[model samples]
Target: MGDCVIEPEQDYKGRVGDDPPPYIKMPQNIWPKDAPFLREGLYNYYSHVFPLAMKLVRIFALAFGLEEAALDGIFKFPITGMRALHYPPMPKEECGTIGLGAHTDFSWLTMVLQDSVPALEILNKHGQWVQAAPKPNSFVCNVGQYLERQTNGRFVATVHRVRNQTGERRYSLPFFLTPDPDANIHALDSFIAAGERPQYEPFNVGDLYIRRVLPARHRHPTSVKYRDVPESEWKYELLYG
Candidate 1:
């Protein structure tokens, strides 16, 4: 785990007592040179899924009542990060016990491929934890903060986590899609009514990734250094936990 963001003894930021979930994060820029089998498998998956992801992006643009290519420029080169997560059995614990802490994806979109294990759970509007059981040959897709902000909170990002209670190992692969680094993040004019104000501030995509996203997972907090970015420049309202 030398290169992993969080160590085995470490906990996810703000999650004091919970253990960091076991996972291998694969950035699109890196590949395992020695592990041909694993590398090839992931490459195959990426090749097939990337085109489909673009189609989904276009669909989302159309859904937002914008031109089909409205979002094409920003997502021309997306930050596609994948995670291979493993949750071991803990049958003695209650089903609702957290395998992964509650959190929302701050990226653009996420598609999760799960094994035949009922571990993933999502928080519903009624404030209840609903099981996201695995369906054969299907994926669970959800929007993220980026889209929510772009749409001025029209598309809500789902809050989700994992809970292992089946006395069996649970595995999942989540592919995260984020905008290109230089893209600007702001609410579209179409999303706001006349005389209404936009709810979010404009910020560069890369700046947020470096300042907010990286620091939370850094092995040494000081490893991620940033200039004096004003608090207002990056802070945004989170409607859910």
Candidate 2:
């Protein structure tokens, strides 16, 4: 996994100024141009991890009597990508917010592999944060916006955060899986028919991607308004508001 750190020629320091830190792309054909790490990661995820995730998703779908493929079309091309993250040791004074801020992923699914460290936490419905401990050879999975939309309020996209509380350096690999750029994301009819009404309005995955790629302050105004709301809240508001 360390071999994946293909640094880009230009440092990302000056590019974004002081928002979220800059991300450095791999230097070599670490992700071959033709393959575009996005595609490569998707391939690897589908081959190695999708079965497990899909099994869980399928069970949830069956509870609603929805076909397995009800969610398949949404994952076509599955914009999956790997993020190699390194959190430096924190100073005693700034120990409170050492890792990442509280936020949820923007994709359909996220599979994380932690290396001998525990830094992730999930926010429950009551808004309390709970630490997510590392399990041996097991990956941490979280639902994302696309799936939350497709499930029509059946499944959820939960809130999560990361913090290096032990005053130690940390490294992690998060594999993000998303819908194809051109795919349309909306509540599935079967889900709606079996469950409650669709919670979110129909939206194109490409449009969401564009908004996500831009700076948070620069994202579409409507999207910014509900950035901190739970997926359930945003799903309804985005659909009707």
Candidate 3:
């Protein structure tokens, strides 16, 4: 459907964090015209998840010893993006076997809906990759890099990957929730105590998004849009890692 689909080749330039595998991404505008159910289904799911995510944001702030309303203003104008991903079977003996490479999501939170296939694996605290088995009718939510940065390692951004060894096509819908574009993302004062340094410098969410995305999408490095983001702040590793 239209231009919403980001082909694998279009995203092969930068392999900073994850070696993105082949998958189709359909945002709302380019949802299939023939499959009305798809558009409606995604819309319905988004409606339910948005409120849940907002609630989670406040809860996370409170859990980290801050006031419940501390993180509220940043999300006043949230940027919600959803992707319907289809990962075909990749038999270990025949192919590379990685459906999606390991990486921490770039958003504040990522809610994933799996179609009951055990392809998702998360790197646990013990440094082991464990299966995140699907439970019926429930979403698996993961903290993303943005939250990890804001909390200054108090809440880790888990590293996760996908491998379709089930020998069947795997379908998943992941919803990414991010703060407003103009919001500044920085480690909270509560996270940085006296004599301790902040893990990351303050930066605008919009500029960070542009720097991280343009290269990944194989856009020309010399584009005027890149001038807005300084070279010091151009790479995702500098911003989140």
Which candidate leads the pack in TM-score? Answer: 1
Model 2 lDDT tens row, 126-228: 8898888988898888888777887776768878888767767888778776765657777767677664566799988856765554346446664666667
> Each model's RMSD to truth, in Å?
10.7, 11.4, 9.9
lDDT of 1 by residue, 1-241 (tens): 1122232211222323432222323211345688867766775776566567779999988988899998887864455667778887766656557789989997889888999989889999999989999999998998888888888988889999887777687888888888866578889888999999988888788667656654475564333332244544542111000
Model 3, 126: alpha-carbon shift in Å?
3.5
Q: Which candidate is the best by lDDT?
A: 3
Give the C-alpha miss distance for residue 87 in model 2, angstroms. Answer: 0.7
Give the per-residue lDDT digits (tens) of candidate 3, residues 7-108: 221232232233322232222154458888986767677667767877888888888788999887776545567788998776658453777899999888
Write the candidate numbers in order of decreasing lDDT: 3, 1, 2
User: What TM-score against the true fold does each predicted structure earn?
Assistant: 0.78, 0.65, 0.76
Candidate 2 local Cα displacement, residue 150, angstroms: 1.5
Extract clashing residue pairs from model 2: 6-26, 6-27, 7-27
**Candidate 3 overall lDDT versus native:** 0.70
lDDT of each: 0.69, 0.62, 0.70
> Which scores greater on lDDT, model 2 or model 3?
3
What lDDT is obtained when candidate 2 is compared to the true structure? 0.62
* lDDT comparing candidate 1 with the true structure: 0.69
For residue 132, what is the lDDT in candidate 1?
93
Clashing pairs in 1: none
